[model samples]
Target: MNRLIVTGASSGIGLAIARRFRRDDWSVINISRRPCPEPGVTNIPCDLAQPGAADGLADALSPWLLDRPRLCLVHNASIMQSNRVDTLGSADLRATLELNLVAPNAINRIVIPHLPPGSSILYIGSTLAEKAVPGVAGYVIAKHGLVGMMRATCQDLAGRGIHTCMICPGFTDTEQLRNLIGDNAGTLAAITGLSAFDRLIAPEEIADAVAFAAAAPVLNGALIHANLGQRER
Candidate 1:
């Protein structure tokens, strides 16, 4: 069976993507600090931001890779902190960088050696990488750094037949966004409708985009923008 590793599988787009892969009969291993309720997903709980987490996760997954024909690595764990550049604390910036960029890059580096040839590594990036908004200075910086990581990895690993890509999604209806906007339904509605596509993209929509990217052989090093037609550069 095809073996895949997905991070941040406890909720939102990660949960939905895990469910989709399970439904397709893929052997899905989910890594997260929280629990994923989806059946058929083997949960590997780890705090990705901690020291040695990448090496530990790779050790835990190495045995499974022995019998699998394929490997797909998806880095989806991210914590969004709302802080303007002027008001952000040093600790907040450090934590954001650890989780959003450094940890993912570490995990991918450790996992790559164990992957089969032709394996794919997918990074869940953000539209903010190109277009910055207010109150998320740390998040925007981390995501932009993540895009650079993806591109460099693609160039470094393409010769070995390992594909790397970035899938940048716009603001979507997820728990993360809900927490960011709070109970301001009017503001949320207005922002949702401000997209040129006339709607906020769903988590499942992004999950489908992930699946498509995984299946496309021509997509090595592709940086796709899935933003409901908004904030395209």
Candidate 2:
């Protein structure tokens, strides 16, 4: 069976990605702080916010990767608290960079060698990755760096038939958003109405895009913008 490893698989887009692969009978391994969403999928508990978490993820996944003909690794776990550029702290920036960009970089190094030909590496980015939004300096910077990482990975590994792509999703109606905005009607309306239909991006929609990227042979080194014209450049 084809093996799939997805980080932050306990919730949101990551959960959706894992579920999509599992639905197709792929062997799904999830790494997250929370418990597994389903019984069949294997869950590796991790706190990506902690230092060395990236190295730990790579080490923990080594055993499951043996002799696999096909493999997919999705980096989706990320954390960010509201902080403007003017108010951002050095520690907060370091933590954000570590989890959102640095850790992914390290984990990629450890895992890429074990992947055979035809493997896929997907990085989950944000609309903020290309565009700057006030009050989220850390997240914006980290995601932008993630895009660079994805592009470089593609160039570095494409010759070996490994495909790397970055998928950037717009404002999504996930529980994380709920936690961030709470019951604020104005913020909710503004975010959800970013699209032409005035609806928030769904986790399943992002999952669909990921699925497409995984299978599209011509997509190596591609950077896809999945936002519904939100903050379109």
Candidate 3:
């Protein structure tokens, strides 16, 4: 049976991805603090921001890992902090890495070995993974590290038949983005204006790209930007 093991499917893009996979009849296991609202998604209940959280998940995840004909492991959880590079504290950065970087590594160790030949590992990155905007220093740093990690996954696992890649989404329409924009109409407009499409990307669009990447081994090691074209300043 095909399975999807995803992190942070409690909401936003993560939830959309889970739903999409479920629609295709893949069993889903979500590791996050809250349960995915979608029916039939098994929630593992993890707070990824806490260090060492993934370390204990091996036993809990073993049942799903065994004997699956195909698996898609998605590292999708992340936190965005509003702090400039000069003002970003080490503690804050460390916390972000604990969730955004370190946790994925720990989970990879647990799941990668058990993956079947047709399996894939996908990272949900951001435009910030390639370029930076002001005030989200911690997220940018972690995402940049994630890109490097995805590239290394391709190299280290060469000839394993386990493909890997990073999917970078632009200013997507999600609860996270809404919270970032708050009640500022101008900020929302400015963000949309930066998108060549003049609108925020739907979460399902990114999810669709992930679904495609899972099946396309030809895209291994690629950094795919699903963001609608962004107008450069």
Which regions of candidate 2 deviate over 4 angstroms?
231-233
- Candidate 3 displacement at residue 31 in angstroms: 0.4
RMSD in Å for model 3: 0.6
- Ranking under TM-score, best-scoring first? 3, 2, 1
Q: Residue-wise lDDT of candidate 1 within 2-112, one digit each (tens)?
A: 877899999998998898878778889888899889988898889877756766666777777776477888989988877999999988888888888878877776787
Q: What's the CA RMSD for each of the models? A: 1.8, 1.5, 0.6
- Give stretches of model 1 more than 4 Å off: 231-233
Error of 3 at 175 (Å): 0.7
Candidate 3, residues 1-233, lDDT tens digits: the string is: 69999999999999999999999999999999999999999999999999998999999999998776799999999988699899988899899999999999999999988987889999999999999988998999999999999999999999989999999999999999999889999999999999999999999999999999999999999999988999999
Write down the TM-score of every candidate: 0.94, 0.95, 0.99
Assess candidate 1 and give its TM-score to the true structure. Answer: 0.94
Best by TM-score: 3
- The lDDT values for all models are 0.83, 0.85, 0.94
Clashes in model 2: which pairs?
none
Model 1's number of clashes is: 0
Model 2 RMSD vs true structure: 1.5
